[model samples]
Target: MTQPHLLYVAWGYPPCRGGGVYRALATANEFARSGWRVTVLTAGRDTFEQYTGTDPSLESQIDPSIDVVRVPFEWPAQDADIRTYSWLRAHLPQVWHRWRAALDTVTFPERGYGPWRAPLERAARRIQETDPVDLVLATANPYVTFAAADALFEEGVPYVLDYRDAWTLDVFSGVTLASHRSRVGRWEDRLIARAREIWFVNAPIRDWHADRYRVHADRMHVVANGWDPELLGGDEPGTETRGAAVSPMTVGDGDRSHPRFGYLGTMTRMVPLAALIDGWELAKRRGSLPPHATLSLAGYLGYFAVPDPEMLATIERGRAIGVSYDGPVPKQDVGDYYSRVDVLVLALGAGRYVTSGKVFEYLATGKPIVSVHDARSAATSVLDGHPLWTATESIDASAIAAALGRGWQLSQTADATQRDAARAYADRFRRDRQLAPRLRVLRDVATTPSESRG
Candidate 1:
């Protein structure tokens, strides 16, 4: 059979260093592995390398056979890289530029992504004229990717929208999205109605979108994030050598006494850092934790730049509560970091629809997980059956303290059989396994003549 042709639209791709890029790369590669000829349309390398911290290592995850097209992008006022700035911008006051950039985000639903609409629309039209595409898969954040897909749709090209996060609903605030009366809101509503299929990262998000767009529910699907085989399958300790620890006495060889609790991913305002600090303080006050228990956080703060004063204050407060900020850990070193942790802290914002991608990766580590989000969150649904997870009802310090104690207890006595079960549970969330069925559905949609033309 001739492989299906797909034009994938994403603002961040390999080398962009954003969290969503991992899923985009995995999705494109998996589709290619399943007999699809994929062409990825993304922002140019200059934007990725200079704006977002570039990681060439991520490219290794991309299938060399996949065709990727890089188009130029310029986010108004967000050019932190000195090289990208003109003489005027370079000389202009920093405060002035910052204000201009902030204004752009409010002007459109997607911060920094709105201005790229024209260029992206042109790119889509050019791609279609040069080579007819069987389908278009647009992953959103800037949500401007939807505009590009809409261009394709106008030209009778079928497209699917991958909503890594909802465009309309405020996931963190747990509020209804802007209604159709607003300009951007109307844009999203119309685009969604015309999409061939819509994929959300979790069920709650899928349900939310379904409830809003009831007639389009048949086209909506859920494709949760999962573990990458390359990142998960390896020696138990993975890449980290025993000598890498800061102190020898702090940890032991295959011993749980010196437990390291790690939190991996971005440290943003959305996270309940205040509650986390309180919980950490309670853990310290209990005096029951092992003397060597250390909570190490590994990730960036404040988008791509260093955190602001408020974020720094939160970090300082965490230090007061025995939580250490170790800065960002690259994706390549994630497995090594996981190996060092006896327990993982899944601290996140509360909402019925919000499920951060970290939960999937954390589950794959086979360590006891202490969830510091809402018990009713979508993440709980994924971790519910996993024996190693201890979820709390709220981010209250007392609740978190109790959960932390239980997690520590579990870590102290969890046998090899228990660890094996945890690992087995993670096995079910592999990237390929999570994405295969979704690809099949897209394939079916592409072949179905009635729905082939959006």
Candidate 2:
């Protein structure tokens, strides 16, 4: 069969360590592996470095057959080093940013990335003209990529949308960020009206969109984010880390001394670090946790790799109570950090739609997990039946402390059987498994007549 030529639009691709980058990377490679000629459209090198720092090591994961095109993107607010800024941007930063935001919206409604529509459209049109694009799959956070897909669709080319994260709906708070009558809502309606498929990472998100736009409900799909088997070790049955469960009574070995609890992944302002720190202190005071139990926050403080003095100060206050910031670990070295920690902290903001990509990685580790977010999270569904999971019913320090105590207990007692079960449960969420059906669906859609898809 002649391979389908797919144009995959993702603003953040390999090297950009943004949360959604892995899914985007996997989508591109998965298409290539499924015998599709994939072209990845993303921001240039400078955008990653100046905004979200790049991970050059991640490039190794991309399939050689796939073509990656880096288009220029300017994010003035993220350029922390004032010296690198132009005169107007340096002198009147607020005015420059306001002007830029206004200019960006001319192409689309999204801020920071709306201006990318023209560049992406031009690139897509040129690529399609050179070698006809069989299908266009655009992933979004900037949502402006929808404009690129819309541009192709205008020329009678069919397109799909990968809603990596919620747009008009605030995922963290599970609230309507913009009404359907609003500008963003109208754009979403117009885009979905023509999309062959609209993919969301979870059912709740997919259902929300489907319900909101019932006229285009059949086009929506749920594509959950799964762990990278290469990074987390492939689905080998009966693995050591596979079925172990955490015991509540015992803490750690006498020789090891300190019981290690680590939170791995981006440490953004939304992470509820203050609550975590306060909870750790509460746990220690209530004798639910050992005095020497170490609470380690490991990973980049923000999307961009720059240090935040204020955030650092927030972490620093925890030092007196056994909390430490271990700094960011690279993607390649992430497994090493996982190996060293006894318990994994799935610290996230409260929301039914907020499921961090890190959760799957935590599941793969088979380590006892302490869910630090509200129990109402959609993540609860994934971790609910797992034997070694401890979750908070609320976001209070007391609830978090209680959850932590349970997690430490689980870590202390969980044997190989429980660990194996945890790993096995995670196996179902391997990236390949999650993407397989999606690829098949895409293939079916690609073969459909353009008019039928429209």
At residue 11, give the lDDT of candidate 2: 89
TM-score of each: 0.88, 0.92
Best by lDDT: 2
> Tens digits of per-residue lDDT for model 2 on 1-454?
6678899998888888888888898778778878899988888977887777888878887888999988999765666677788888878978998888898787588887777788888998898889888799999887988888888888878898999778888898778988889888899889999888899988889888888899889888878888775554342222454333221122235333478999988878888899889999999999998888998898888767686677899999999999999987778777777777888999998888878889988887877999998677788888888888988878889998999999888887888788878877776777667788878988977777677864
lDDT of each: 0.78, 0.82
- Estimate the lDDT of model 1: 0.78
RMSD of 1: 5.5
lDDT of 2: 0.82
